[model samples]
Target: MKKIFTINCGSTSTKVAYFEDDKMMCKSSLTITAEQLKEMPKTLDQLEFRTNQVEDFLKENNLDPKDFDIVVSRAGTIPSVPYDGAYEVNELMIASVTYAPEAQHASTLSCLIADKLVKGLDVPVIIYDPTCVDSADEIAKITGIPEITNMPVAHLLNTKMAGITYAESMGKDYKDLNLIIVQLGGGITLGFHDHGRIADWVYDDEGPMSPQRAGAIPTRYLADYCYKSNKTLQEMRMYLCGQSGLVAYFGTQDVRDVEKLIDEGDEKAGLILKAMAYGVAKSIGQLCVVRGGNVDQIILTGGVAYSERITEWIKEKVSFIAPVTVIPGEREMEALAAGGLRVLNNEEQVHPYIYYPKGYSSIEDIINNPNELA
Candidate 1:
């Protein structure tokens, strides 16, 4: 029996799961409160603290790190990710992730945590469907501005798995089907799979507004807000991505609460819920044209997909394009384990980690001395 350990590092929490072969043995989530997070101001600083949390969980569950045959990790915005599939974690991956093009995030430390867990053991650590798994075609990458290119920064771990799951359910190969896979969570993303590759996409920031993200807003209005909001750049950033969506109106990201409010006859809540579904359906329609309305299925998967009102609203709008299938909840842990199993069974080709020439090798210098960059 092959033992697999998967780690998904979040903002202030670590989610881990153990699988013996294809069955999940146990799973856990280790969350850190705001006070505890204050101790590690830098993301990398939490590496040791979070790694210890995973160790404790394993120990408490009577699972040893040494006994695991392989370790799988969740990754985010690392320098050019190899998009074909699962990649073996390596030094180049670590170095590039530390350089982090945008803001440094906790999931960037996933490889670090995975490495620590399998320190002395001869185990392979692989990351599956990391953020920024760019597969958009040349035509899809174009923007009106020649200087800028549209890239696919998506919730690929869940979207890809959702497509595969549907393909298998229909007794068809993923490579032969044309699909529009929508990931509805705190942020929403739509990926258009042409054959096996993701040929087009409606990125979270450009697509539907979600529980946390504002998604697409008027460009002129947003540009005006940059000047008139009188808010710091960080605050403005939060407004665009973090503080917008449901949280902006209701101060909560949970759709269950919104639905409860609807149940209580809250008219405003019902309106916002319908608007969310409208935006999702509009994005689905946009992607449908990408393939000339030849889509086989439109699949919805993620936290928000659990909402019957939203999914049904989306289905109501886009059911003409293709049959809509709702597969609720995040399956990141299962996706990671499945990817690892594919690698172990030689069912998929494993790619080597590639580094960005313009990336940093280490954050060690800056971590110890904040003034170094200055």
Candidate 2:
């Protein structure tokens, strides 16, 4: 049996799993407190510390790193890669994550830790379906302003895995179906999966509001607030991405707590929850239009998908487009393990990591400088 080790680093926790082929033998997670994060402000700085945690876990579990044939880590927000799949972790990937504009996420340490742990072993380290996966169609890239393009960034890992799982359940090929995947969690991302490629997606920051994210708001109002609110760029980002949504209105980021308030006859909380679902349904409707109304299955996954209230609200608005499949909670770790298993079984090719320089303002620029992508 081929042994694979998978790691997924979230903002506050690191999940490590040992898999023997398709079966997970052991799994563990380490939580980093707010104090620890405050001391190690830079994501790359936590590399050695997090790697030590992984090593400790391996030692406690009586597993030898040398026995593992493959190691896979969740990808961080690197420079936008045009393709998706298992990417061999290399210096280019490490540099891209280390130097990217928004490299503050804990996931940036994934490849770094994996690289250190698998050294001197005949093991391959790979990162699968990073958050920056960009497979947008040409038309999908066009924005209202000529100077700005609609970049593709979303929850590619769980969304794509949910789609593939649903396709398999139907005994259909993932590459032969049109799928609209909605991931409801701390942030919500709605992706239009056309056949196999992700034609377009609403970036979570710009899509439906979630438990912690503000999602989309009126642009004119946002610009005015930026001018008058006297908040720094980082503060504004925190307000929009981390402290907004339910927390901004209800002072709590937990969806279950909000649901409890609703159950206890809080009309306002119920209305806010319904409004979030409505926003999600609206985004689904828009993506259905993007897919020309030929969606085969609408898949819902992530933390909030477990809530029947939210799913019912969304279903009422979108069941007309296609059948809805709810695969509750996250499948990210399993997805990483499955990707490593595929590569181990020779079912998929592992691609080399290459960094594309920033500042390509137009499609014409990309067309003109083909070697830049190389």
Leading candidate by lDDT: 2
Q: Residues 198-302, candidate 2, lDDT per residue (tens digit)?
A: 898887678789988898999999899888988876567767876789989898877899999999999999999999999999899889988679899999999
Reference-based TM-score, model 1:
0.90
Segments in model 2 whose C-alpha atoms lie over 4 Å from true places: 39-42, 45-49, 101-103, 357-374
Clashes of 2: 0
In order, the Cα lDDT scores of the candidates are 0.81, 0.84
Which lDDT value does model 2 have at 33? 75
> Model 1, residue 265: displacement in angstroms?
1.6
Clashes of each: 0, 0
For each candidate, what TM-score against the reference?
0.90, 0.90
Identify the runs in model 1 with alpha carbons over 4 angstroms from their true place: 33-45, 230-235, 357-374
- Clashes in model 2: which pairs? none
Query: Whole-model lDDT for model 1 versus the true structure?
Result: 0.81
Report residue 240 deviation for candidate 1 (angstroms): 2.9
RMSD of each: 3.0, 4.7
